[model samples]
Target: MELDILAEKENVICEMVSNLYRTKSNDDSEIFTSIYNQYKSIHLQYSELSKNNLEALKRGLFIQWYQKTEPNFLSGISDLEQDAEKQIVNNLFTVINTKQVDSELIWMLNYYNSWDWVFLNYENFRRFDTNLVNEANNRLPENIDKKLMLKRGQMGKYWLSLIKYGSTE
Candidate 1:
């Protein structure tokens, strides 16, 4: 009888943990066996106990759940992280293809590299006041606007592409 009760309790704990990742919050008791208040109290007890007795309860929340649950929850989380990283890498490749030598691309490159282009000239323009920019803007001719815009745009894209995809050929 005792063994049966322990098995049932273990099953309940496993179910609660499996549902934890699906639930909106860790405090939600819908996945737990006991009443909400009781579950909350026990949760608090566990948290406090873990904090006070670090040597015994040093394992993190995910580690604790993985240890108790029959399923490999750790692998699931790991796979999710890996898949997200892969998607980011794919998007990075798409950005790399944006650089080209067409007229429009040349214009973009010029716009980005201009001194007046804030993003492209961030190294020089960052922390500079609006007054300084306005002074520079007033002094510069209108045709230079296109050059600044294109230069800034190109430089911004170049640096961003470099950071995300590294030096591309």
Candidate 2:
């Protein structure tokens, strides 16, 4: 299929994921499972496209979804960070960046990179607020990897700042 058509389809999938997140209920495992299955199907369909086209489609869809949903969706509570929908979207982004697209493509998307866009946009980003970060730092386990924790905390803070300040930079 053409890149435009594939992107449109991916946009639909993003909308579905967004709706699912918005309407999530307690004990939503079954709904999440079904969404995961649907994502797998969409992934398979995109696998048929040429690598460049697939990358373009993913990038286009990412921008489209961001523009369409960022205002309300970015700050809303959702299990998106741990959800299969995020996994699938991130997988596509990884594939496109590592396999299909070039440096320029990376530069373009790097402003609102996929990792920050998906993982950091979760409600949990608030946990890394400065007041809470110090408390979290004090509670860290002795045997735990402090470096990893610090890096994650920094990422969380960075993402939170971006959202709170409304600047992708």
Candidate 3:
């Protein structure tokens, strides 16, 4: 898979987790765990992919694995820009509505652990963190204006703050 695609998937899955958290329902934990588990597998695969297809995987084309295996997988979450967006939103809605949180923290921890994988693992990726140069090497395609990586960074900081001071809001 291309790095951008993986980054995009990470964005989608993170959005799904955030949406699940927003539902005000009791099932956020369960839904979070399920999605987190799927994310873990992808992380493992990402390592393997980074090793084998260093050049091609940067494109994030590897996400096709989930698209092929899971039913309405991406479609069940939120709307994506490159592919169909609403499918992901729907997928996320389905999971949260059906389950209860059992091991939600596990996924949350894994998500935090994987942060370095998405941002710090690449060669020219550091450039993106500084200035948006190297068109082909940018984590996201130049055409998309979503600023997802920025949002994720904000969310990550917020979560860490929650762990340190706690969320009073």
Q: Which candidate number would show the highest lDDT if scored against the true structure?
A: 2
Tell me the spans in candidate 3 whose CA falls farther than 4 Å from its real position: 52-169
The 0-to-1 C-alpha lDDT of every candidate, in the order given, reads 0.30, 0.40, 0.37
lDDT tens per residue, model 2, 1-169: 3544544554455556567677865775665566545444444444433233545344433433343345423322122223433443455455554665543334324433323444355443322223322322333122333333223211222234333334222
| Candidate 2 Cα misplacement greater than 4 A, ranges | 52-103, 108-169
Each candidate's TM vs. the true structure? Answer: 0.19, 0.34, 0.32
Taking the tens digit of each residue's C-alpha lDDT, what string does model 1 give over 1-169?
3323322333354455556656647564342334323323333333344333321121122222222232333112111122223332232223334321223323332433343332222222242233322333432122333322222222222233334333323
* C-alpha lDDT of candidate 2 relative to the true structure: 0.40
Clashes of 3: 29
Q: Which candidate would rank higher by lDDT, 1 or 2?
A: 2
Global Cα RMSD, each model: 23.3, 14.8, 17.1
Q: Of the candidates shown, which would achieve the greatest TM-score relative to the real structure?
A: 2
> Which order, best to worst by TM-score?
2, 3, 1
Write down the TM-score for model 2.
0.34
